[model samples]
Target: MNREPKAKSQEPQTSGRSDTGRSERAKRAEGLPFASERLTFLEHLTVERGLSRHTVEAYGRDLEYFAEHCHERGLALPPQIDEDCVVAFGPYLASKRGLQPVSIARALAAARTFLKFLAGEGVLPADPSALVSRPKLWRRLPDVLSQEDAATLCEAPEAEAQAGGRLSWRDRAILELFYASGLRVSELCDLKLADLDFQMGIVRVTGKGSKTRVVPVGRDALETLRRYVALLRPKFAGPKDEDRLFLSRTGRPLDRIAVWALVKRHGRVAGIPGDYSPHTLRHSFATHLLEGGANLRAVQEMLGHANISTTELYTHVDAKRLLAVHAQFHPRG
Candidate 1:
């Protein structure tokens, strides 16, 4: 552990990432404590697993942190990882990284996956993370918007859409698409010309793990998207824009951060309270549907949740609503 930081400290830094067979990122992974195994795992993640770049990057960081921790104990990951090492990782994350319980649990999950991968590869005899208890986190409900607030936010850009400006209906369309279909930010950005069916009022979204699902879009949202495509997207489409449904001023497809900034900007424009983000609209979309008597299975399908349990969080509603229902229906009261 003590010798590794020095070995890496003297190594020259490499800039720029390549997506070739052996990328710079993969090569850097090879420089980690478990050089070969880690590099192979990372390459597997990109080539075979087909994880998104962001997700793969996160997994790589997790492995790097674990390797750094191991570096503190030994020059590199030992022939075998014991349970004690996995247990120590939790405290290390808490004491050194100041990670919250949820974050720590997530990091541990990444480690567990890596360990399992190594075990399968015969590099490790068994998974050390198997016996470790992940931090038990409280079920924190997501923040949701009221119907009126969501509508207000969606229309906030209308006032500024005058005379076919630079933004035009693009921002409004972004918000509407989020609220209407409960699409994740990445799914929204990944949308393409072939994904939309205007006649059916649905959008085919490629979600996490490259899973695709058709989510119905409201008529209003479809209309806004149509207007944005017809008015702005034509000019925004560059030779390289491909068939992406959303684009920046430079005709490049919008990235996650750009769309998030757009959402927050319009949130302030709507004068809504508390911080607003793209996911807030998604949460609102699920909650409003459940409150409107939408079936749980249906909502789960719409949200593209692999598990119904994840979708059930919207069933919590809000404390105020629960109390009101209790007051109205409880006979003992």
Candidate 2:
């Protein structure tokens, strides 16, 4: 087990005034009814619902931004706010505040949730936020490697395998499983030794919201995993008999950040450009399946999307590729 030491910081400290100012604003904003209600909701999400701090903060920020927008519009406090007020706030955010479509949509979603909470608590007569429509924008397709590029990336572990003379099989297995199963980085890191069923060719994954699903492993991925388990993993296992499928050099479970760095390193080796990460492989997995004529429902199931709408992003990717092909070969000038 070889644990890398934390790298020392080299950059000089910037001004702290901006940080102090934001803190002050956050404190003052917490006093408002909107903010107070948000704090309560956040507390519920954390303590009762057991959501991660990252998710709580994201929801907090979204609600806080909407509350600030309402304040700017001179709308009466939470009790006085109505659907029309929220509807107007959308244009206000877009036209006057110059928020992007994604930002507006997030804010709207937050507001809807908060308003529903208020309605449930009998604080408001109705859920006004529900009336606010999310802004519609052309879906921005995810970046994915072509099949050749994906193959190149999967092969990148060979170099590391040869140089390190250890964990090469493990690295190859990780890369292969990622592209083959379309597992989210978190899901991949969470994998356990017991999750793989070699005979059945299935890997059980616990996805977002802690939902469990079984994904079939391709032949290449299964072979890679077999070799890794037989040749490399034993060398890295510690006395604890930890079940984690992927491990750090130090014989601990690999964390998400480490997985992200590994993906970037392999992308560089594969000549992939412009901020590629582990999710890029997941995106590639989905897009490549659609391009290969897989049905949307099947892709949705494999990707573990709770909603068909969530899976529809690949449709946009598929359309763009079709447009490219038509332009390249069509006779129309």
Say which candidate scores most in TM-score: 1
Clashing pairs in 1: 1-71, 1-74, 1-75
lDDT of 2 by residue, 36-141 (tens): 6788888878787776555676788777677777777675467888778778766766886788988878777777878898898888888876655677877677
- Once superposed on the true structure, which residue ranges of model 2 sit more than 4 Å away at CA? 1-57, 64-100, 165-167
* lDDT (Cα, tens digit) per residue for candidate 1, span 237-305: 887757889877657777776788778877886799997799999999999999888999999999999
Give the distance in Å from residue 272's predicted Cα in candidate 2 to where it truly belongs: 1.7
Residue-level error in angstroms, candidate 2, position 115: 2.3
What TM-score does model 1 achieve against the real structure?
0.86
Q: Model 2 Cα displacement at 195 (Å)?
A: 1.6
**In candidate 2, residue 113 scores what lDDT?**
79
Question: TM-score of the candidate numbered 2?
Answer: 0.76
